[model samples]
Target: MSATTDGSRVRNLWDEAKAATLDEPGKLLYRSNLLGSDKRITNYGGGNTSAKVTHRDPLTGEDVTVLWVKGSGGDVGTIKLDGFATLYMDKLNRLRDIYRGPAHEDEMVGYLPHCTFNLNPRAASIDTPLHAYLPYPHVDHMHPDAVIAIAATRNGREITRRVYGEEIGWLEWRRPGFELGLELARFAAENPEAKGVVLGSHGLFTWGRTAEECYATTLAIINRAIEWFEGELKDKPAFGGEVVAALPRERRREIAARLMPEIRARIGRDEAKIGHFDDSDAVLQFVGSAALRPLAALGTSCPDHFLRTKIRPLVLDFDPANGDVEALVAGLDGAVEAYRQDYAAYYQRSKHPDSPAMRDPNAVIYLVPGVGMISFAKDKGTARVSAEFYVNAINVMRGASGVDDYLGLPEQEAFDIEYWLLEEAKLQRLPKPKPLAGRVALVTGGAGGIGQAIAARLMAEGACVVLADIDANALDATKADFAKGFGADQVRGTRMNVTSEAEVAASFAEAVVEYGGLDILVSNAGIASAAPVEDTTLEVWDRNISILATGYFLVSREAFRLFRRQKLGGSMIFISSKNGLAASAGASAYCTAKAAEIHLARCLALEGAEAGIRVNTVNPDAVLRGSKIWSGEWREQRAASSKIGTEELEAHYRNRSLLKRSVFPEDIAEAVYFFASDLSAKSTGNIVNVDAGNAISFTR
Candidate 1:
């Protein structure tokens, strides 16, 4: 087996030289990482690997077999040594003595901690019994798309026999639990020559006497399925063939930009949502296919895929050939309402007496013909991951439908797994959401110190930020730094010249597509020029006014348009200077533009009141520290006018202030954060002076 595999085979990434230096548990971690490195083998957090190692008891001083498996809610690819749960095999096997059949199997999960070895704190997953009872020293269980594709077909058992002969067996679908583990042990004991078994409508399980052999066996089994599907689906029309040709790429994006906010507004009524758009070839093919509606209605087959994507997706009534987007928009209210009703009905029919309450009824995945797919969730990462899971479902549908009749899990069974008590407990244990959890903001002049600080403050409270700046290099660096601190999904960068009407419009459009829609706008892009009235040229005057006054106007206008479209209300914060209120010498153009920004914000506040769009301003004076505006001729001119050396400018400004303190960019950012958050909900058309007690610059 080669180290890397294309679509035709599974890559053999195990390094004997590397494995030789590690102990048994270390080798298990190595095997798990290697298997998870390929999505073709398993989706994120969808699989588990195990090794049974001999450890001397801390108290008894005698060697005993301990089963080490991936812990609850852990991802195999990124798991660490501490990510595994260790249990004594004898105690795990003893669990069968108290097992009271499938109805009481859930209670078994409560007893797993008692079986812990060496006082490991990591919680064992529900699949612990499956790995514990297996007769092999090493075991692998994965939800590979190709294997699940075979397992999801009506004729899956016969197909399994034909493809793998007697080397691999097949078992009908049973939710993972203690009873399933006994069944697996029974099968292994009965068929001593079998290498693995395909769990119908679920995934694959393989084992070996050694870690290396187990890793190789898992790859070979998945590769065989992949090879079989390649031959079987060779000439078959996928998803009953595409019925609609994909719209042009740019046209598709335009449609998504228009539709996402409308959909987001409706679905996000209970909790705000972030959106992800996927126009990948796989998504386009599935959404544009003749079988799209019926197959989607049947829902996903694998539990892993179904959980993230919801039971099924909502198929939009769109036709690419006609290009009737307005008609589609007109029908959105009805379409969205219908999906909600259908989902409620599903929950009503499937709910057990003790089942957890139904979750958000709106579908997670949205299918649009001629375009692609859109997924929404509480945050960007979940939305993106949900879309990726649907693509996996799409691939499963293609392979199963092409070779045999594709079969989705029974509705009741899916509901049991979805609302399982254990799953509910895990959800309850998640940390509370941050203050601005689902909010999205756009910050202009985002590469500047004030802008960066403001963005960081918003993101710290869980807001997704789009850093828009004309300086491409600065924007990239700031975006990277923010992404490293927050996650990559929480921040995006776009090149935007705030003064250009087109650029402002494009930037807002990008925000809508990137993260559903905007909730806040920070107009901070600016320039400072210092010259006596006689020396101030037209070029210098225009430069100051264009970026300070007109730039603020352009971005605010675009934000208002988006805010109205979303109908979710909004917040806008303008970064004005203290000169807007207090006169400053030799800076006629700069002072005039700064004053204009404050007035413009006041005007917008009045106009946007009915729509719940609050506009406010933050004024700062002599904020010399880390400010790009204070780095150039403006500093020298101000120093000269104050009759102080350039190097003494900070002291000069501090001594002039009533409180004798210097203002910094962080002070301005805090004022902006207050206005951007709900803390200032009832205080619109307000001005906050962050000038460290500059009495002349006070808002009063």
Candidate 2:
């Protein structure tokens, strides 16, 4: 509802009317959503909530206590009723009998399915037992930055006593499983007056006799920590004071745009990565501070933080005073390689005989002095969330380091959590990646039917798209539609007139900033005109050439420059027309401009061959459905020239085609998809006609 927290208070969003209409499980869902709605309260998917509810057993015909906990891989903020795993509380208690000790804790995860209640297929998470063992009707586990700050300091237990006194207790760090559950149960039994416990270097756990009480208590405890930190650290210099002043906002963005593609090109070798850049006040304050290098090296203290950000970040060697970007670029290879070696050594030092194989030995977060932070991942959402997690770590460091020594998780413990066999099993269970996963594409004229179709098709295969168009209103609507079907992170839109060189260049720069860099460029912007050569005015000829011919050149040239910068190869699909290779009466201006587009693709293809930048064209004829070009006088002119009414154009074109099929925007989109994907990996300087078998427009 409000920004996570405004320094002292976390908003309580529980409405009496809303809670009154829900049952016990519904109350738990509501409480979980209210807690998770704020980032300062918990990071995405970093917390779990549960309620011990009375349910009538289908097989037993008797009321039993069911542990309804947030399921594996579910985010509490957006979770539905089905996202919670239902388990018999009695069966979960029985697991303690076979739980041997810490060495056998992992085996307990495999036995959770035996405790399923009502056959709920949602798998239980590791935190399930922690909630099940708690002697409360409602329980919440959350990773609020303010509370973790106190929990991550060297003297965390002492600080916990100072902050909450007898209201809460503290427990030393233990990996979540059956063993930790037992420890929690023991703590609750010893301190009956305590409302919650801060797990060392981890998070906070609170309980109540009812769902609303639990939700209010969780907020109250976190808000107290926030207020305490504000009062204690009011005079302290954050991150041991700033060593380097932040660069200007525009300068920081310019540097990020320059470095992101270079970093992406190197780290994306094994699997392509999408990147996110953050120059927020918090990120800049930390990255430009005196303690940045040491703090970054020590890594994040929370397991949730390190899992997304990796054990540590690669701090780039850049000085804002000198502004020597070229030197930094030259040294990137060595810096990245060194980080990889260090990570591989960490795995080697801590791995057990049964540990999963080492994953990509690359840093997920990158720290740039005076610039900001950059994160790369298999998708835009993960990259952005990874950055958010690191920012949370920074907040913890600021509060912890200001008042006490900030301590990171032990290396061996962090490694074991990262390489746990159970974690590996979860990774293996994920769905396979789509064809265009991790790729970025820019589609000109994206508001139009053909452009929208092409953009949708590429997104279906997992490519992030930036839509550029001249119509502002249309562009916004189209982007909103696509974002709904795909996701907000997968699509963006910008207004541009493709014929203007400056606008074209700026649009490409925006794309680079939005999504690391470009991988596919669809030059589809167009205009149509019809007139006899003798009657064609200079104004008519120039207008057609400006948008259709020169516009293609401007966009193509920008794509080439970016492709060369990234060094990751690229695909450029020019949406030309059937008239490019075939002549039509009384349409000299349109035909000539279309022809120039095809030749430009050929020239660029020849120059880009050695660099793996493929160029191709998709030509379509009589695509009258939902096309902006057909909504104008061009339709009437073409219909007049063909000696047919405008309403009969679709039928005429379909009957004239060899296949007798009408060409739609979707048909053209399929052809463009081929060129944009690796399915056309070895082919370049090619043309495909989507005119339902146009004999006269055949390339051969």
Candidate 3:
């Protein structure tokens, strides 16, 4: 919901999508994200949506049947498949021709299993063809609150006419189905270069072939409208006590968490994961108070909002200890019904035979008695988006037309988007797995070559990593080097003993306190001890287990606890040696501890999976020459025993596997990075052999 912005002119969603078409998956993902974001603005699911797809013809010996749509019961905010209907592009293109709204659509095939619709509501989102007809590979559309607010004013139509020229077309609100989409297509095609559009008394529309362009254009128009209004309206003095600026990102969420439950309680449901979301202070402050000037209906900016934001946020008068769920629900429902009826009357006024009529309000917005205007999304992300859209909507309406002269889509026209098939498709989809963006991570023993390599890799692909180790000097030195190479404050360091509970506890506390949350843990700390079983002392055995095995348990246990509490899930990795599984004569406790560590990793994997955590191990053999435990003399001896020069010995060790090269700590680090990242999202309870291909003891 929060996007960092700089001063730049905007392009349209249509253009952005077109440029990004080559990244077919990215195009689909970005467009869907855009649409999902749009839905958030005014609770558009069941309102508006977008999609970017690759279409080919199987009949003509080509690929076809690419679709992403919002589903029947889908919300723009949390839309997934079942939210969208997939059909051959040819079929959708054909449907676009006969879409004469209620008249022609009433006779068309009703909802099919592939339609992604519930039995009661069989309407394809009206904007389906609107997206399908896009010349660009990607498409985006939104029922902006600003446009709608301006459109809904007393002099809405006149104000819109004055603010925007035909560079953006204005349409009379009409019934949605095939008809509205056709009209939109015709308008778009006519003004190929037009960057903006306004639907009289309805909403606003912007497009681009690529995500960046589309997002930019949408923001540009909305922002411009807002600026215009602010300049024209002239402030009415700061009322003595000046209004304060908004809070920072973290503080905003903190405040929202405290207020969310109270808002949810008013809506009447107690079981849900709505907490995993974001919110807007501007929206909260604006809508929370009924005392604010009530201008017009910004509830369902367009029907698409319903899918994402659930019609609109309830307007409740909340207090400190209020548990009156019934009153709250009633108030919310009553407000929503009022909105629905208002829409119904508007529909009646704007209806024609080609129009498709909807039965109720897709979404509703409540002017709460005191708290603020809450933009509701089906989920947290959507809600946050809806609030943003609302903010833009206010800006557009006020900017384009004076506060009292807003314009919007007519009821019938709004209906078409509310029931758009293509728009729904945008909602009912999944992102093509970016894996770990915006996620913070930590790598234990990260100062060494292996840890450094893994940390660097993760950072390269966009992940924040905290390099931790017990060696204070090494930790600081590593941090300095890493920070230099990456950026200021890029790699952080903490020195703590893996074997010490107090130290481990202290480290974890510091991590959680500093990073807010941790998503990855690479347990790569261990000590090597060479002793025949006959001469292995209990003290040595205990030390090995303590550092190699028990330490693993301690580190893993706390990470597991943190994962559970944070509920975001995480990944844990253990670095075991090939000796753990194969017989190595001189090492008894080392092998045993490592072997036990592997099993420990497996068991941990099983338990953590429930909480979305993953556990895996890497067996690295002969890759320890430069490790703290291995000295230059040790390396020389190992190389000599191989009957080759040191470099050749290293190459032999590396080449021992399928590839003939020495496996350095970096090689092991790569494996660790994979498991710690999304590449191994589904890979848990498994062991990766990082020793090239040394067949020490063929388990299978």
User: Which candidate has the top score in TM-score?
Assistant: 2
- Once fitted onto the true fold, the runs of candidate 1 whose alpha carbons sit more than 4 angstroms away are 1-4
Q: Weakest 10 consecutive residues, lDDT, candidate 1?
A: 1-10
Query: lDDT tens digits, residues 393-465, model 2?
Result: 9999999998899999899989988998888999999999999999999999999989999999999999999
Prediction-by-prediction clash tally = 0, 0, 104
In the range 243-325, model 1's lDDT, one tens digit per residue, is 89999998999899999999988988689899999999999999989999999999999999998998899999998899999
What ranges in model 3 sit over 4 Å off? 1-101, 105-149, 152-155, 161-172, 175-178, 181-197, 200-202, 205-224, 236-310, 313-555, 566-573, 579-616, 623-644, 650-700
Q: Indicate whether candidate 2 or candidate 3 has the larger TM-score.
A: 2
Local distance difference test, candidate 2: 0.93
Assess the local accuracy of residue 477 in candidate 3 as a C-alpha lDDT between 0 and 100: 89
At residue 587, candidate 2 shows an lDDT of 97
Give the alpha carbon lDDT tens digit for every residue of 538-578 in model 3. Answer: 99899999999888888898888767755567888888888
Candidate rank order under lDDT = 2, 1, 3
lDDT of 3 at 300: 39
Worst 10 residues of 3 by lDDT: 268-277
